[model samples]
Target: MTEDLEALRSAPVLETERLLLRPFTAEELDAVAAGEAVAHFAHGFPSAEDMDFARESLMAGGYFFTESVYARLAVVEKSTGEVVGTAGFVGPPIDDELEIVGSLAAGRRNRGYAQEAVTALRGVAFRDPAVTGIRASVPEDNAPAEQVLVAAGFVRRGTPGLETEYFLPRPA
Candidate 1:
């Protein structure tokens, strides 16, 4: 895990017109998990919920730092040069499929930032060629998240339990 943390320093970055989906440095991930402020994070960025999620993911296996399409990239607003959220794959491809997750600071929502970030992530995943499909799931009532995935070209799959699933296959 320590080596993974060191490797995270050089993780690839994906950019969009208005956002940069950059991987979090180990230091930034540490700060977020500890609920401490990172210099480049926007006000209210990495909300309490985000902090908890980071901590949980870190303890699980540090997969976010793996040298693969799986990563927890910070979603930075290019104009402000501040991190407004995070978007990334849940882990390396499983059976040639990967799952993605994203979240934004309260103030950043509804601005199409999430859509842009997810689109960037989707492009990165497909670039690997080994990835055949990408998936994301939103809570049943989270219309905005569902819309973001749809806008990124993810098709509605089905409701599996309390969450609705969306999937985007590699471009033909």
Candidate 2:
């Protein structure tokens, strides 16, 4: 599906009660993918696994505002101006649906940052009109992620266990 690259490029900065969600610049994405420390981050950068994921996602060429519903945003804490995590759509919408992806820094978890980030992303997705809903898949062992999704109003939609899928419909 062809996407409006300009729209993606012009993606807005989203603000929540305690967070700011800003799209990642190509350079920043590259830096993260290379496992280098990003400037202005109080906490350390994303994990090596996350960097690998970012690299693979970038190489796939449809995430990060080129031709997909991507928004590789950095989740920043409003108070300290620290980058606390990463959050956004996994890729372009498929069948008008997309998956929400997020990861808080190891030290930033359990403080409700993930839920706030996901909630803000949901607002951004629904604003587009093309997005009908958002989904998230979490490993069964990842209870924290499940709680985050649940707090954000995502309900489990299928068989529960090892890998569970959750869905949240766009509000009318």
Candidate 3:
């Protein structure tokens, strides 16, 4: 609910079995904010124009904080402490329901880091009294992402057709 950038500034790194997620940097924020990283997704990357638009609407609004502020931490390899990619939520709408963590980086896909990252992030998310559920939206054709979420305890709760929705509660 709070959009204070200071709230996320200097946030502690979140640890996982094989990864560490630290707050996103201004450079990384600019890259994502500028749509430079969209080519990595199965879904069409956000265009520079789109990112420019979002810069004002989403970035400026601190949405990445909850709705779209750049509150993400870099996802890194635990053993090497090398950055593998990023993990965290992207929208305020999700915060009001389930804390939705966007998936991991393209290079890091299939490494099971996504699963491990979410597993850890969910623990942190659920620690808050308002959090009740956690959810993710994997493209219908993204088998790897679906596998990661399913393996992490998210089960289908909607129609099996396109855009199917799956959900899981925060660990009690």
Off by over 4 Å in 1: 1-10, 60-63
Q: Give each model a TM-score.
A: 0.85, 0.83, 0.67
Candidate 3 accuracy as lDDT: 0.58
* Clash statistics: count for each candidate: 0, 1, 12
The local lDDT score (0 to 100) that residue 105 gets in candidate 1 is: 87
Off by over 4 Å in 3: 1-12, 35-58, 61-70, 78-82, 93-96, 159-161
Estimate the Cα RMSD of every predicted model relative to the unseen true structure: 4.4, 3.4, 5.7
lDDT, candidate 3, 1-172, per-residue tens: 4654444332446776677777655554566566664332223233443344336544465445522323445566777555556566543335545545454445456777788887877765565556678777665887877777788899877665576566877566
Q: After aligning candidate 1 to the native by TM-score, how far in Å is the CA of 55 from where it should be?
A: 1.4
After TM-score superposition, the amount by which residue 155's alpha carbon in candidate 1 deviates from its true location, in angstroms, is 1.3
Best by TM-score: 1
What's the residue-level lDDT of 67 in candidate 3? 29
Pairs clashing within candidate 1: none
Q: Candidate 2: deviation at residue 145, Å?
A: 0.9
Tens digit of per-residue lDDT, candidate 1, span 21-108: 8767777778888877778888787888678767976787666543345777788899999989888877777899989887898888
